[model samples]
Target chain A: MTPVLQIKNLQVSYYTDAGRARALDGVDLTLTAGEKLGLVGESGSGKSTMALAMMRMIKPPGRIEGGQVIVDGTDLMTLSEQTMLKARLSKIAYIPQGAMNSLNPVTRIGAQMVDAIKAHDEGSSRADIDRRCKLALESVDLSSSVFKMYAHELSGGMKQRACIAISILLKPKVIIADEPTSALDVVTQRQVMETIDRVQKQIGAAVILIGHDMGLMAQFVDKVAVMYTGRIMELSSVRDMFTDPKHPYAQALIRSLPNLENKGVFNGIPGMAPALLQLPGGCAFHPRCSKVMENCKTQRPPSTNISGGRILECHLYSEKA
Target chain B: MIKLIIRRLLFLITVIWAASTIVFFIPRISQKNPVRERFATLAISGGFSPKDLEVIIASYNTKFGLDKPLFEQYTDYLSSISRFDLGVSYNKYPRTVLELIMDSLPWTIVLLLVTTVLSFVIGNLLGAIAAWPRAPRWLRTFATPFILLQGVPPVLMGVLLLFFIGFKLKLAPLGGAYSTGVIPDWSSLTFIWDVVWHQILPGLALLLGSVGGWTLSMRGMGITIQGEDYVNFAEHKGLGGYTIFKDYYLRNALLPQATGLALALGGVVVSAIVIESQFGLPGIGRVLDAAIRSNDFLVIYGVVLFVTIAVATLMVLMEFIYPLLDPRIRNE
Candidate 1:
């Protein structure tokens, strides 16, 4: 099966007051057609940075430093800004973070959705556009009357649904949803996720679900990649990653998930990730890893595929063994 | 809305009446007595009769009914205000306070209203361009120099421009709307030409410094509005550039500034006293300046009251008009 989106050795950096800071470093990932991949990382782990770099949405003082983000077959980094804008809304839709504030407050919800569809397809008739807009809203379980209501009048969940509906209306080949449920309550989060899942199947599109919640990712994504310190620590099938995580950082992350029975008690990963401007000499996570060896301190680990179709960047599993 | 407007009007009327009454009493109730001043003037002129002066003063006071209760005095003041008879000029030879003000009122309104509105419109447009991201380099460069031009005082600007453009160049008349030989005509075209010709110097002086501040304000407002989340959301929704600027940014920013401008209208007219005097223009400002210098209390009081009422009424109108511009402010 041909991969729908292929990001090869991508690096994103920002020029801050201090100096140049690498946000995402050499990220290599792929998603096959109709595949759902979960990008699980804490804030500042370059998850959103990677997604924004793909869309060329990084404002100046921040830019994609190196490598390519190949969406379908076209290399996005090579495309001009104007062309990229066309690709952005039409081919690969982005449901940005803070979806509630994403719609214009003065305009009615329905007009904005139709505008999005019209922006991508100029030749589409007004009647067809209106029909698609109503269908899109209905698909998200929102009332058709919501189209008539202004943005401020809609509830937070409804706004999120409206944004999602607008993003997916064009039936883009790939959807990059950056924390679509982070601002929502638990129940609303579930509904939004279920909507995304249903839309993914209906459109038969690839999706990159980037968020910090691992348990939520497990419920829907076909694969999961745990990232830390601007690097992918582990990539595996969702079931395997949860069952037996090899990377020590991945293990610590899974152990940190709160237990339902003991609500008050939680195990959190010890120590902070290394600063991007000052990454450790070798393995960035060595200081935080429990099984850190002498070799792990001064040498970066190469990503090696292990048994059970799991890939890990750790010195624990040797090729000789 | 009707009740709100009515309440505002009533409140404004009460305030104006109170202010006018206070002004009326300043020469009488204050330690600098009008009686003493009158006596001093008579004595200086070699006229003798303290007893005769006292009787005359008493009679005069009684005739005006100043010996009555304060509330009764206030009622009389209100009655006189309603009739547009704000008493006679204490110093001007044979003119009532109303007559003096009426002569200059038209000139003041024409100068102030025309210049203020023109500056506001022009400055705001330039400001929007300066704030627009895609605005060409020429606009950005021009705005800087224009702001520098704004810093010059209007009086200085008036003197310089009057000397260069009027005296040296002889491009326009030095002062007044028409030549001495020409009679004032009732024709609409000639009347407009007369008004425009008389307004040239004062208008240019006012525009010189004021437009800069207006431009700066509009530009600042544009920048601030551009940063608002709604503007970005508008862009993301693919709104046309001009429409976004007009409805989203300009409309919201212009609301409060428009109110400030309206409230300033009366003050602008009153405050142009120096400019009018310098140009020899027959406006209320020039007349008010002369009245104050001559201690013409009645004329001074009348001009003050007229200005106070005009400003207050404008403010009330602004309050009523605000809701139509900003939907969020409606009913609040």
Candidate 2:
């Protein structure tokens, strides 16, 4: 079956005073129907850039240099702005990071929801829009009374759930949730994640959960992709990723997570991710890798496929392959 | 909500009462005496006997309630005010203060209300257009002149407009509400047109001097509102440019401007003073000016009391209406 979303060799850059920063460098990702994929990385690893690029909403000084954001079969880059806008809510929905500040404070939730619905389908009657809005709110376990309330009236958790409800209102094929639970408390985070999972199941849409919490990613996503310095260092099934991380960065990230069972001292990755403006000549992670070799400093590592559909972009894996 | 309004109304009454009391005592505390000043020329001419002068002074004192003790006079003043009886004017004797006010109030209201509302609407529209992210670069450049114009005082603007537009171009009448021969008749179109024609220069002066600040404030607000996350959410929701502009951008940007509008409306009386005097219009400003010159304490107190009540009422009204516009304020 065709994937719900496919991003091929996507490249994005930010034009700053210092120089052009390669925010997203030749990244490729695909998600099949109802698949939950987690993108984990440190700050400035281009995870958020990738999410924005998928929506084609990059502002000035930030440009999508080259890419094909294929939602089902449509190439979003080639579509006109007007067409892209129409395609956004109907085909691909984005739940942005900050739920606390998302909705317009002056407008009622119901009015704003109706605005989104009417933007695509202007012919929709008020009763029809109200029915759908009520259903969407109920799906998130929110009462219909919240529809008349403003964003400030809702708690952080409720706002996040409302945002999720809005994202799935049109039942788009792909829902890109960028750090959806980062701002909530632990309990609220779990509840919101459960709601997202339930809603995704109900809608049968693919999910791209972007976050930095390795533990949460391990529990939530079916597949996990580790990103570093604008490059995906490793991609594997969550079970394999947690038990046996192939790339050194992935291993370091997992090692840093405190394990109650073993009670070993947490070890963090040495050195920082390379600055995108002046990236290292060869492998971007070479300077921080303990298993680095001379070839790692002079040449870029190609992706080598391991057993069980796992892929690793490291010289150590390349030699074995 | 009713409780809030009631509290605001009580606060407004206290403010107005304090202002009225201060206005009533200012001329009395000053050394200048209306009765003595009005007869200064007669005394200098030495045309009356000492006995005749004594009788005139006594009658003037009785008429103005100066013969009574200060406390009794104050109570009388307050009681009369409660009864809506503003005393007769000292300068324009035989004419009550209320009648004089009634004559000039409509002209000032027309001039101020028209100019203020027009400037606010035009200025905010231009400012929003200039601040829109997709607006052409040249559109922003148009705001520079208006920004500079904000520094020009309204009185100076009125004089400049009187000199250039009224005197040099001769496009409008120089001063007064209408031509000397035009009778004040409601049924005559010519009379009404003549009055409006006379108001053009002064009105334009007020508009030009005030529109700049509104534009600057609204531009700042619009730019800030554009950075809000709801704008991005609106975009992701497939909202059209117009929908985002109206619903997200303008709606949020208008909150501060609404407060500014209320404050500006309250200050209309203060602004009208300079514009009215400079244009030589027979408005409240001119009446107050004459009262001050002749030391007509009753007239001065009456006009100031009217302005105080107007401003206080407007402020209270704004306090009640503000929550309806901004939801964030409602909970607070």
Candidate 3:
């Protein structure tokens, strides 16, 4: 079946005074309907950039160099801005990071939600919109009175849940959540993640969960993709990624997670990810990989399918499968 | 909200009382006393004997309440304020301070109200437009002239406008609320038209002088709000450009501008002074100038008290209404 969202060889870069930073070098991601894909990466790894690029919401200085963001069957890159705006909430919705603060402070929640709905469907009546808004709030376990309240009146967790409700209000085919719970407490994070999970399932929408926490991603997502220096290092099922991560960066990420089963000092990856402006020649992760070969430094590692749908991009994995 | 209004009302009353007390004592504490100054002018005219002059001076002092003890005078002043009695003008005897102020107040109110609202609307609209992402290069270029205009003092602007537009081009009347011979009749369009025509230069001067600061401030605020995450979310929600501009961006950006309007309203009296004096309009500022030169204590105190109460009332109203405009402050 055709994927709900297919991003092919996406290239996005930020033009700064220093240099052109390759935010998304050559990202290729596909999310089928009802699929939950977690994009795991450290800061500056371009995970958030990919999310923004998917939504076509990249700000100035950050340009979509070349790419095809095909949602359902339509090529979003080819659509005009007017059409793209219409496509945004109806075709795909984005629940941005820092969801707590991502709301117009002066407007009431219901009014803002109605604005979102009416932006695409101007024919929606006030009564109908109000009903839908209350329904959306109720689905997130929020009281209907939250509709009358302003964004600042709500707690952080409520704000986040309100953001979730808004994203799924239209039941878009795909929802890109960029670090939705990173700013939340552990318990609130779980609750938010569960709400996202339940809403995604109920609406049958594909989700791209962008985050740096491997443990949380493992618990939340169906598939995991490890990214480093604007490239995906590994893509596999959550179970396989947790048990046997092929890529060196993925392995380091799993090792860094504090394991209660084995009490020991957590070992983090050595050195930082290469600057996007001046990436190392060949595999970007080679500098931090312990099992780095000479070829890993000189030649870019190509993705090789291991088994089932598992894929790895590393010189060491070349001879293993 | 009612509680907030009541609290603000109480605060406003206190502020107005304090300002009134200060204004009431200013002429008293000054080296030149109104009664003595009048007596000096009379003495300079040189037509009276010393004994006769002393009797006239004592009677003048009693009539003006200057003969009373200081404490009794203060109580009398306070009581007069409660009764809305501002006292007779020191220079224009037989004419009360209230009558003089009433005659000039309408002209100043018209000039100030028109110029302020016009500048506010034009400035904020221009600022919002300039800050829009798709704003044309020419629209952004609008900022340069406004920024330069903001740096130019209101007096200079008034003078320049008076010279170029009023004198050189002769496009508008230079001074007064109306022509010298025109009767002040509301029923006649010609008279009303002449009044509006007379205000053009002064109004333009005020508008051009003040529009820049509002434009600059609103532009800065607009640019900041554009970068906010909610704006991005609004865009992602497929909000149309106008909806996002009006609801998300402009609504959030206008909070600071609203606060600015309140503060600007407070400065209206001060701004009017320079503009009014420049245009030679029969406003409170022109009256104030004459009052200052002649040491008209009652007129001075009354005008200051009026301005103080107006500003205090505006601030109190803004303090109560601000939360309604910006829900973020509602709980606080």
* TM-score for the A-chain in each candidate structure: 0.95, 0.97, 0.96
Candidate 1 vs candidate 3, TM-score winner: 3
Q: First chain of model 1: TM-score? A: 0.95
Clashing pairs in 2: none
Residue-level lDDT tens digits of model 2 in B181-297:
777997899888988888989899888988899999999999998988888888988889999999999999999998899889878777888888888899998889889888998
Q: Judge candidate 3 against the unseen true structure and give its global Cα lDDT, from 0 to 1.
A: 0.87
Best by lDDT: 2
The TM-score of predicted model 3 comes to 0.95
Error of 2 at A172 (Å): 0.8
lDDT of 1 by residue, A140-250 (tens): 888888888777677888888888888788787788888889899999899999999998888888999999878789998998998887789899999988998888988
**Cα lDDT of model 1 by residue, B211-253, tens digit:** 7887888888888877775565455444456656776677666
Give candidate 3 regions above 4 Å deviation: A319-321, B1-6, B39-54
DockQ of 1: 0.24
Local accuracy by lDDT, each model: 0.79, 0.88, 0.87
Ranking under TM-score, best-scoring first?
3, 2, 1
> What residue pairs clash in candidate 1, if any at all?
none
